[model samples]
Target: MKFIGRTVVLLLIVNILLVYMHYKQAGDVIAKDSGTPTYQQEIEVMNRSDALYIRHHFSGLSQGRHEIIWPEASADRSCYALDAISCGRLDASLTAFVDGDNEKQSISYKIPKENSESQAMLYHEPFVTLQGATVTSTLFHITDETRSGGMWVNGLEQVGSKQMDLIDYTFFQGSGGVQDLYWQQNSLPLVYEGEKLAVYGPAGHTEQFEAVDAALKTIGADHSAIVIDQTSIAVQSQRFIVSENADIDKASTLFLTSAMAARYSIPQQERLLVEVVASILGDKAIGAEQSRQAYDKLIVALTPEELALLKEVVNSKAGQEMNATILDDLIKEVTGFKTSYFKTAIQKDTADHLFLFEDTREVRVDGTSYADIGIVLKDGKSLYPAKSILSHLGYTVTANEQSLYIEKEGRKFRFPRKEPFYVYNERKFDVRTSPFEVLSDEVYFEESWFRRLFLLTIDKTAETIDIVNLSTVLEEVIE
Candidate 1:
């Protein structure tokens, strides 16, 4: 009896070991089968190769025609290279190879002459664009797509303490012109100079205005808001605030946005806007000179009323005393400024015909006809009540705090509150307008829900919301 009991215990231990070994083996097999390099890894590898190719080809390709080819798939499975060899003529005509997934594509440019001066026209071809990198063509030529020339990036002989990624160099053969194009990874263009373009990025975290320093004028405003009395009786308060860390470009952008939104009809009104912006950031190191230049150009253009308004806001003791509240004040003084958030109204069309469902049933909900059922605002956006539409289509509709749930067959869709985006079949889409509003006890959604999700078309001519039921169509075809 003791021997038999020991044998049973041994068998149980062996079975447990076998089960453990089986799972380990299965896990190893799964890992081996699913070991493809991830998409992000592919992107990184491609970017590095682009850098390499650009470096190798930057100066000039071989003088004669040659075909360059790389494999469609990288050996390490890190990046996707192209499979086909690209052939192009190099002597009389210029050919450009555009990089793409799984294939090589080429575009040709006409070279007027064989001399180096002729090659300067290569810049006319749109240089290659990368996802996180920008390359600017300055003086030289582009033979390679990846690497910028190694020296003097963005005017610095060495990159120094500042950060820079790539610099491409090209020397014009006889013109003795040296062009330097500089770019940094994941940042704005450092130094980009092309034809009809001169743009300079911020030199440091802050900038000092050369004109402000030369003029030797000191202006300070303690507060952001200023109240000006053109007279003792007519009192207006203008508030414009600028943050300490805010640069001139940002100030200009904010000023542009407010001025544009103000919708000023007259050029003088816009000039007043510029003055307000200048007064707001005039003390700052940046934008002061730019503001002054703009003011000089616009000063001659202002009418007497606009000029007086500008003087009242900028040159007066009240204007000087006025501190941070300049933005609000200038916007208010603009000709057609509106304070409301939503400017456009919902738009609707006149209903020419009555509505019916596919089954020949007149569509009605809550004593409202189909024409009255959908609300079209002046913005050309429309919405229909979810409960009414879902019920007519035989869908089970329910609502929760976060979303309105609609289910038909085995498919479910969730439309969230106050979100212009919706989820269907586990996919999210921007339906142009959020179009979802909850009024009292009912939920409403845009007409896009029916057109996009249910694949139904709203026919204004037929005056019917044509429900394209695939099953019914199939059934009719069979009959």
Candidate 2:
């Protein structure tokens, strides 16, 4: 499903993830298979010579231009590269294509009814989304992405507003309990910045987030309980990411996805939610009571709240009394089923656990410590969640997100954004290139290097470092 991990503090602790297992779906299920791409197909797909045409079958051509799209079906089996011929769904101006490009191509299709014998899955009546991979203008220019298995395409710069779809799926071990639940699909139908993941999983269909939200509401404290809190992002990178930051960006992606769930989406947008999250799901499998206990423990630790407060919230606010109606809607887009899904090492007393949100949109400065938070109410200010901030700092804070960075009085520490930042045993070394967060006028790091730097520089220069044990300092930082 669309995964959204964020920190949400209920009026009380009425929070927990709505994890569910899948039993047998109550309908004649549609089947699907992953398509393959060939070298020849690849050349055809990348053939930019043609105004690759694409138009949605369901919506038909808007009052705009249309064209035949490039195909990507042959690049790799079961991959996301759209076959140039099937590369449908191009973004439109709602006006005709200039230069006689408004040619007619058909892809008017939508999810089929359960009983409909006609093509019901995504592959069947596989509608084409014009401008499927076509990049557009945006503040955050997306260059490319790490697609399933391998690269989606070469020379592919990521961007916003690309035509996309969602897939709803459940991982089941025969008649047994659910093993995994995933709602794979593109979160943004189009975007201005950031890599949009193209997720088309087992259930080749988009689900109704609104319905899932409603179902979630029904499960509130009365049926179940859940409390969510704000999240602190931790970014760690192994190598310098000049063009992109993989590990770091992944954390930020989760953060943004969670934020999206916190906010509701419109009908058109809501279709992106996966099936499990779109509706009240599997109750016929697994140990509900046992699973519930595990879930409770997971959430309680996530909040790091006093046991008393945790008891109060889950017992009352989240105790099926609230219905978590808002969260239900949230799951439509930012869907997370289990409490563990939301739980992350948001921070630690070290920088090793930190993650980056953006590679270039933001910057980092040398510091001994810091905090990271969001503008909840926009008082033109926001409260820095202690955990969120300290985790970003290299301090010995309670939770990693709320961790701190401290060093010896006379020692100095240094951390950089690029790769090969440190050195190895003999040559220069490398460190997890996680960026720290700034909050409440402090830089927090969950990894050791950033923390050591912050700690050592407590009273000394924030820039220059002591030269006596350069190699030693680097070695200590490596581990």
Candidate 3:
């Protein structure tokens, strides 16, 4: 019996040793050695303020690059409203890897309901890197605001081969909802001035291409563009150049030569191309009819020869067939024009605040319009009535003593009266104009609120306000 007991004890000891060895091996592979330099830092922003919590881990080193995995479970969130407490949660899953050389990086992330089809991937290997480029960002503004509060880092820390910089943007907004964590890397040159694409179009059509290019540039994109003559166009093996040789698979803009566009089967690939361009431009690209109209304006300005060529290309038998059926499809694919189907142009009443919603519904608010069909307070800042606009946008609005809440689909927006800021999905942001105010039993909010919260595009000269739901647009983009 004593021998049996000793045998059992020895067996237990062996199992314990085996488990410890396995864990030790895993630890070595996962992290690095104790001497490995591991540090962390965080930047927090509350519309602008900060708080940082960091920890460093050093274990035994292994082969391959280090992987940074994000939390997959729903994170708890809390907010205060009207002396009451509210709770909500948001789910996200993201992973990133910084190559051992520290010069390359890749990220894969899923944005819960915002994106579900597949994970988005971004890989960077220093495109146009400045030799001594610093990673400057609006995050520095956050650091400046929080420094006096003693919640910011006064020093820097480098982890592994890559540096650790965590930016936390907290919207000190009103009541409970999901918060958007926006991380924009403004490190590249011309990050703010914008990027441009070299446009290659049919020969002798510089004025035609220049018109469209200038319009896009005025909207803060495709800046300093070069309109190249297609016949003698120089093809640089690069990204973002709109030319015949451009890889459509990777290129965002496609410049369809007259011949190539003619070869497209009516109502099929041509429509697809328009859709692709609209998806790429997101908010900037206009619809087919609008594009056609813009093209018409450009043609009117074209020289006799250029105009003649355009008419020839457009009035050809192939163009006739495409224009008859496929033109509508192409126009339907534009991102921001809700009035594409309307035959008549929306007339702008600049004197009064008259807004044509989708060129179908017209609303003449008592207040003046600023920044176009949006709203402007009599005080010179922009503001709008929540019920008047939200009702038109298919949103259900509820009224309370202290605030007005508007909801559409699964999204919610809260505008609190007398507050300097408003909350969307639980995150807060500062409002240039007062978010909500009660005048004669109506709730009023800033004109920019709807645009900022709902992602709706407002066009002043066109006198049109796009009410198309952005989520629906995104779903279409996904499809």
Give the best candidate by TM-score. Answer: 1
TM-score of 3: 0.21
lDDT accuracy of residue 383 in candidate 3 = 52
* Candidate 2: tens digits of C-alpha lDDT, residues 397-447: 322343233333343223333433532222443555544445324454433
Over 88-122, each residue of candidate 1 has an lDDT whose tens digit, in order, gives 22222222233323222232222221232211111
* Residue 439 CA displacement from its true place in model 2, Å: 17
- Looking at model 1, report the run of 10 residues with the lowest lDDT sum: 37-46
- TM-score of candidate 2 on Cα atoms, chains taken together: 0.19
- TM-score for each candidate, following the candidate numbering: 0.22, 0.19, 0.21
Q: Assess each prediction's global lDDT (C-alpha) against the native.
A: 0.33, 0.24, 0.32
- What's model 2's lDDT at 240? 8
The Cα error of candidate 3 at residue 27, in Å, is 99
Task: Residues 1-479, candidate 3: write the lDDT tens digits.
Answer: 54344333322222222222222232323333333333221223232222211111112212234444333322221121212211111112222222233332222122222322212111112111112111221111122222222111111111112122443222211111111222222111111111222222222222333344344344332122221222222222112221222232122222222222333333333443332222222212223444444344333333455444433333232313443233323332331222222122212211122111122223332222223232323344445656666666678889777877888876787777667787778889786766555643556655566566766654443543334445556777899
**Residue 347 accuracy (lDDT) in model 2:** 16
Candidate 1 matches the true fold with a TM-score of 0.22
